[model samples]
Target: MTLSISARFAFETDQPTDVLLQFEAAAIPEQRIGKANTSLTQAEHCARVPAEDDIGERIWLRSQGRFDVEYSAEVTIERLLPDLGTLEALSPHEMPGEAVKYMLDSRYCPADSFQSFVEGEFGGTLGGARVDAIRQWIADHFDYAPGSSHVNTTARDSFIERRGICRDFAHVLVTLARASTIPARYVACYAPRVEPQDFHAVAEVFLADPTVEGGGAWHIVDATGMADPAFTAKIGVGRDAADVSFLTSFGPSNFLFSEVRVEKL
Candidate 1:
């Protein structure tokens, strides 16, 4: 399936600010890019860098005065979602070195802190079923309130509050999976049919053992229940949202407005 994405960002600055942007689709094995373009106004000293794990590209720029930026892209993504019952979680020793980091605690996803609860709830559950249960548990308990969470909100806080946005949902799920000894990571993506039309957050679990009909793969899940795996376009992957923010400014800058749009083609 092909997806078209467009985003606009405006910032009002008193002096000058340096910004790091990660709005482009990831160059992963499952995604093929057709075309992409970006434009910046009142910006200079621009450069590009690849994100960790090759998940996406980041652009760095210096903006002065009233700054405006726009990005557009068209990409084709191939998603293979296997039956939940047909996959098995891999043991820590069996997981690859790269996957090991995801199983550990991060800034937003403090898996170690939730060890007791996760073990009590999902220790006996196996494979993708465990992940599905976690997702459902979050959806049933948490309220999807927009301003309920901030950048400093951690999984523990969200679990206690029972409310947050997509990133908070992803953080809690990621923490629960890691606490259950499953390798999971946070994903930033362009989600089709998302209410309010903004960048979306999702989670991916690495399944190491598979049934005859199901292969070992990274299965995507949206705890917010706002995205379909087949239609979502991945932008970046990280231990948590801290590593995949769409825009990070070094200097002080006030946000004027932002808009995002995604459509299936």
Candidate 2:
């Protein structure tokens, strides 16, 4: 499959400011089965084109001064790839304790409160009656509110605060899954149900049971439960929100605003 995408950004500055725009533009590199190939494309300070291997893409901008800016990104991910069986074999009764430890201690996400919450709440397997329980637990705990907190907000804080965007919800889920000893990752993309023309966040769980289908493959889950299979476009994945933030800056940012528009053309 092939797709095309474009985004527009508008920034109003109180004063002239230096800007460095960085967006997603890399092709999905071919990878071995049972492993996810999610990485960011290095984009210059302007428009970008899809790479030869890209099935999905993203666009972003970074400015280097204090000013008001509005930016929009357009992304198209096509060539819907089928999931090949990659799940590993494991006992169904086991919890994801090991996975969680790695994630909290890992450099990807270092929030201490987040680590503790996962260890406390993530205490079961995904099979049998626990699957629904896991889903319900996530859904009941968080509310969807974009821009409620800065990116640095910890999962524990977001949970306590009880309000955040999809990224925060996804982060909590990813952390919980990992803490439970299950392999989980962060997914960045747009969910049509929430709003087709905007970006959102989702979590993916990687099952370790070989007997199950797609053992090591990623399974998309939305804590917000706000997606339609029809309009959701996945961009990339990583340990947490920090990994797949469509727009990342090297220095600092202030009074930032973002918009996204995705439509079939």
lDDT against the true structure, per candidate, is 0.86, 0.51
lDDT of 1 by residue, 1-265 (tens): 9999998988877777788888888878788888998887856678889996887889888877787889899989876666765578776777778888998999998888788997788777887888988988998999999999887999999999999999999999999988888898999999778998998999998885453333346789889999989899999988999999988888888888889999999
Which ranges of candidate 2 are over 4 A from the true structure? 1-6, 10-124, 127-132, 195-197, 208-215, 254-256, 263-265
Q: Please name the candidate that would achieve the greatest TM-score relative to the true structure.
A: 1
lDDT tens readout by residue for model 2, 142-219:
667767988678666676797877777777766665555455667776554564356677776655444445343345
The superposed Cα distance between candidate 1 and the true structure at residue 89, in angstroms, equals 0.6
Q: How good is model 2 by TM-score? A: 0.61
TM-score of each: 0.94, 0.61
